[model samples]
Target: MSFNPFSLAGRRILVTGASSGIGRQIAISCADMGAAVVITGRDPTRLDDTLGQLVGDGHTAVPADLLETGAIDRVVAASGALNGVVLAAGIAKMVPFRMISQAHLDTVLGLNVHVPLLLIKSLLAKRSLQQGASIVFVGAVASEVGPVATAVYSASKAALLGAARTLALEVAKHKMRANVLSPGYVRTPLLDALGNTGAKIDALLDITPLGMGEPVDVAHAAVFLLSDASRWVTRSLFIADGGLTTRMSV
Candidate 1:
């Protein structure tokens, strides 16, 4: 008998956006901690790549486009009863307030807020979740800070913060936990795709006292929320931002 409170052994967990970046790292980390993980992403090839990199067996890849019709049911059907659910499938498009359009708002909010919350509803309908199961919504520091050209992205993430808090109260009677994870300037593939260079990088580094973070940093925090170590925790917003929000004003 050992005292590893963060061990995820004997648990079955599902993680969305597992093809790359933070989602991929979370899936791998969960398997490393001894959990059977079910990974889902829009791209089959990339999802398989992530599945192969997992540290343990019983980790399955279920490629899915959550925005597509009936996709939620298919994902739920493909996954088994779970101890944890990580909703990390989201997109961030930085658009200025003046240029924000309905389509842009719909696209960002649909995946970031709608898809994950809808999937949770489907999981509940099918009773696929285990008692004391934990549900984590991947949010961002944009929810609290005002970043230029990030109006839509900020709204999407802010919605998750409120959703998780309310979801915790609604699901508590079933002994399930709901929480949100907010990361600031994590160096992921997505960040790279957003063109992380020059002024943008320098600006982020200047605000983040500890500089930018990596996927592993956020993954470890996810492990804690998904593990029994945080059984008593729910409805809280856990921020892993390298002190980005701790800057002092002169």
Candidate 2:
């Protein structure tokens, strides 16, 4: 047996949202660990950039929008068989509950929740996922602890935790595992887009014991969940917060 259980050699993994941010980092880390990664994103140029950052060969870039129903099957067909799948794509809207419109709700839930669920189902049905494959879904700390202006976003993320738990039970028979990676306010483009700047952002960091986190922080956790090191770990949530959740008041 190899001494390094974290090595992903001989494994083929699929990573969604790999054009940038946490997803991009996950793809890079997977390749560094010796996995042949298939990365997907809506941007062909950014996907090519991620592909360029990978350390090894056999890394493929599939440019597709995961929000489209038609894209799900296409992603499955392009990925073929895989030892791991990481659902790192998500959307968030931080607005007061009363102001949230139907379109807003749909956009948030559609990309964050519905797309991953359907994509997972498509991959499983197509046998695109090999037995004993690891599945990691990116969740948010807001799911467990509520934050102002994120009611719908919180709901969408919480839904993933519930689904992942049930999925773990259903897929255990096939030696496959399902888990969630919940990250706190990381310095990603998504955060910036959500208006997590100025004093509001400073306030968040003030409460966090370990301060701000980088994309690599989450990528390290994703690698653990994907590697054989976590073969016994499943149906669980691995939180990579910088102590923000711990310092939250009730």
Candidate 3:
């Protein structure tokens, strides 16, 4: 068989946070690329909405809270042996340093960092993954570039980037690639919530040079990383920010 590269026809992918936002887009895109996708989220209704838009066969919805570490095994088992996994399940909260509480910190870090680690631990069981399985963690540009009122959120995401780099090296021998996709402001429900106030929206747009990107922009980059196209790529961070990280504005 001539190696049919870029064809995920026989691949099985698991996408978390697929109820909405960038996760939803990734699930739909994966299915469109011919992969059987298992999407997980806490909201059954939104998950169903995402599943309704998939383009391939064998797409399933497994609703579960990613923060529940003990349930990861069951979730992975339910998804079957997977060819790819997208850790897009995360949370972000804006709070000043003085206003930050342990509970708040734990909530964000638990989902953004701890849950992803646990999920990978469950997926890395012997014979649990295909030979070329790829893993993508949906980190934020804030991982490298900090923003105001994002101390806790940024710290959690930064840990994800750090973990991805180290884990990539450890998993390289298994032919399993791991990388972080750091996106700038994307047109997602999360952004909508954050930018709801006019002043905040303007402040963000002014700094984003190219303005906010659409979810599809991030999804396209993810597809490349998850496919054989990035077979030799590992232990790296791909920033999809619209020059937001390059600016010298202080």
Query: What lDDT would each prediction earn against the true structure?
Result: 0.90, 0.91, 0.86
| Candidate 2 C-alpha lDDT tens digits along 100-174 | 999989999999999999989988888888889999999999897777788999999999999999999988999
Give one digit per residue, the lDDT tens place, for model 3 in 1-250: 6875666788999999999999999999898888999999989999999999999689999989877655686688788888999999988777878899999988998889888888888788646677778999999987677777788988988888789888888888879999999998888888876655332656766788788898898988888889988898887889887878878345
Question: Against the true structure, what is each candidate's TM-score?
Answer: 0.96, 0.96, 0.93
Summarize candidate 1's per-residue lDDT along 176-196 as a digit string, tens digits.
999999988888878876654
- To one decimal, what is the Cα RMSD in angstroms of model 2 from the true structure? 1.6
Q: Candidate 1: misplaced stretches above 4 Å?
A: 196-199, 248-250
Worst 10 residues of 1 by lDDT: 193-202
Pairs that clash in candidate 1:
none
Off by over 4 Å in 2: 196-199
Candidate 3 residue-wise lDDT at 94: 76
lDDT for position 91 in model 2: 82
